[model samples]
Target: MSELTQLSPQPLWQIFAKICSIPHPSYHEEALAAHILHWAQEKGLHAERDAVGNVLLRKPATPGYEKRQPVVLQAHLDMVPQKNSDTIHDFATDPIQPYVDADWVKARGTTLGADNGIGMASALAVLADDSVQHGPLEVLLTMTEETGMAGAFGLQPGWLQAEILINTDSEEEGEIYMGCAGGVDFKTILPLEREAVPAGYQPLKLTIKGLKGGHSGADIHLGLANANKLLARFLSLHGQKLDIRLLDLNGGTLRNAIPREAFATLALPQENAESLHALAQEYLAVIKAELAAVEKKLAIQIEPATSDAQALTKGCGDRFIALLNAMPNGVIRMSDDVKGVVETSLNVGVVSTEADRAHIRCLIRSLIDSGKEDVVGTLSALGRLAGAETIAKGSYPGWKPDANSPVMHIVRETYQKLFNKTPNIQVIHAGLECGLFKKPYPQMDMVSIGPTITGPHSPDEQVHIKSVGQYWILLTALLKAIPEKN
Candidate 1:
């Protein structure tokens, strides 16, 4: 065990350390689910797995609180598997090496998985600690939340018997999230026609790197650069002048993450090679100035490239670049109801050119259904104009904030009494499972809270040590404060 297991909340950190030793990347959570099931059973609690692999555990209330309402602790079991290109760790086999850095705990060369891992650990700690006073408790560890709300979507009616659910997935320590935005996946595919490269053409590689990419939902309002869009912009601005013929294009990975790197290779007449390099440098300067504040380390590199002597036909190349450049990205609209919430946004998260086609995938999020449909319609129109096929998938609903929740009142009062300050109760622009859970369990009252986690879904992910202690205190206190059943 590393020093993280020795942190102030030993029980919580200890379980988190064990979690780091297991590989639980999205869509591959069976092992971790089994591990948690075994642990819960060893503690003498009733444990079982749902058809979709969600783990459910039940524990009786403390001696005096058995008559109070039964509360549910909810968290996802999977983590986003992300790492730097050069990191030598494998999410399928290797354990995340976590260590302490001042007031935070971070992983070595990979995402720390603290986003939901810390939440899971806190739940386990609560279950194992017999001293904490609480009513009957149910733990729900859902699967594949990062990729989609698969577990929540497949959750059967009556699977959980609780009136109040405390989701341990929110990132900020002193804030509580009562609602979140809904989202859908959008993909565009452009057929490619390849031909032998012109006899006098030379291949040039263009790369955009070092941008501070982050969660497309959580960080969209931060003004961070999207590398995929940047690369497409560069190609559109200079391709015609350089007589560029695209060979290959690739960038980004997950639909929920803002792209940090992009690369494209193209063929141009030998006479225009020098001009291409000069224009690249000029455009780099402009882009740098535009993203100077948030993306200080943004970089653009141009170099000679050698590959198969084939390139996209001129017509296809022009259409592809034009469509990519025209797609809307980043924040689309801000909420008029909430002071600092993003209402609608989209991220061109992944782009790739394959043997017969070039593809682009985007994640569109909005608080209103009409806003989501508007963005989808716009993309569909662009795809038609570009002669590309478009498809939308993995759509999920948004959690609407409740202004009259008794559980919210209990949590707020508990937090104020503990910290001597009011917590920030707000809605988030990101997706959460609470929305999907509401479909089957319409009567369930829900709120999300967690320790302070930053740079989630990226290699820079970390959890503040001090906040873990505070989060634990607040959760346990909230449990004790659940009012007696009427």
Candidate 2:
């Protein structure tokens, strides 16, 4: 309903509006891809969809620029589906409702999908606009980017002819990303023995919520509380004093996101319930003061609850607590090469109570392969000690920064020339499709840039209005400046 058509750089804004009108959450992007394929044909450009649903559109070079090397403008097709708890829209069927708020465009109680939608739109606009001089170009719109790098991984090698790739998925307008962290997810299954609730004990629930958990990689160093760790800390510290036994415990939703909420079921003597409450308050006070600046709404709720789930045996509970306390969670090392960048980190993202076993999901990220293995080795050894099974899956490589990259020089010079300000060069701790793309296209020079998007992957996501125009100008200029091939 919002008037995106009237936004500056009307060509780009118009395409963005069409994208926002579709429901294209991760892994459900066929309809949008079909629409784009048809639109590309109507516009008299060569376009086709690959086996994995990635759409590639080709545009010819202008008369004078025929000798320049071709460039691939890459953007993903899917968006992360997240909304406010009270919002009534379904991501699979409902169009995103975005509106201009001050200088930023935001959606109504949901993510704006600006993370890659803006990238896709800018690529589409470049393909459609003929007045801008450029060399031969190809636009690659990938699917299933949010849930994982499935689309990028499925892309076969030797399919693209472009020598350079320009990714429009980076969030900051004034920063160009040259590298990103590689990561792997490991699920540890800890088997704990259960026993009948003791006659003298009663059931109580320890609930923790309102922690501002963020991207496990980017915000790992922020010292945000992992709810699972917090819960385990309390149980481990007070289990003996209060004669505590665990029923089951769960926390977090995604392995790549910091755990925000967690709760544990417990059985303890009724006489110790009041003492338990007092201890919880005391612990809460200490944490509140420690995290006052970041976690303002941090809360821990204590309530009585009845459960048929048997409590973990005292020995099992104690061992479980010890395992949790030993699990690695948070930044492990900072980069020595890239100043202020995190080199290796681990997040205890998820802990779920299953029928027979408790499953813990952790994502480890590092700029170097050995760094990931080091953490994995620690986890494997701990799992062996606890008689747990550790399974690793979906390993992806990092995009190591090339100090001598040719494209990096061109982008930096162009940004300086266009805006009269030097852009920041960064190697992010988060995952990017560029990392995967490099596996097959090793010779392809790649750099990522985009308009400033704040609060990505959440209901508060917004994209700056002014930065969009600036981004477009830089992209247009960069394409023209691409030198002719040798």
RMSD of each: 1.1, 2.4
Candidate 1 per-residue C-alpha lDDT over 102-174 given as tens digits, one digit per residue, 9 for 90 to 100: 9989999888889799999989899999988999999999999988788998998898988899999999999
lDDT of each: 0.91, 0.88
For model 1 the local lDDT of residue 254 reads 90
Worst 10 residues of 1 by lDDT: 1-10
Candidate 2, position 7, lDDT = 95
Residue 420 displacement (Å), model 1: 0.6
Query: Whose lDDT is greatest here?
Result: 1
The digit string of per-residue lDDT tens for model 2 on 254-307 reads 787777778898999999999999999999998889889878888889998889
TM-score of candidate 2 on Cα atoms, chains taken together: 0.92
Top TM-score hit? 1
- TM-score for candidate 1: 0.98
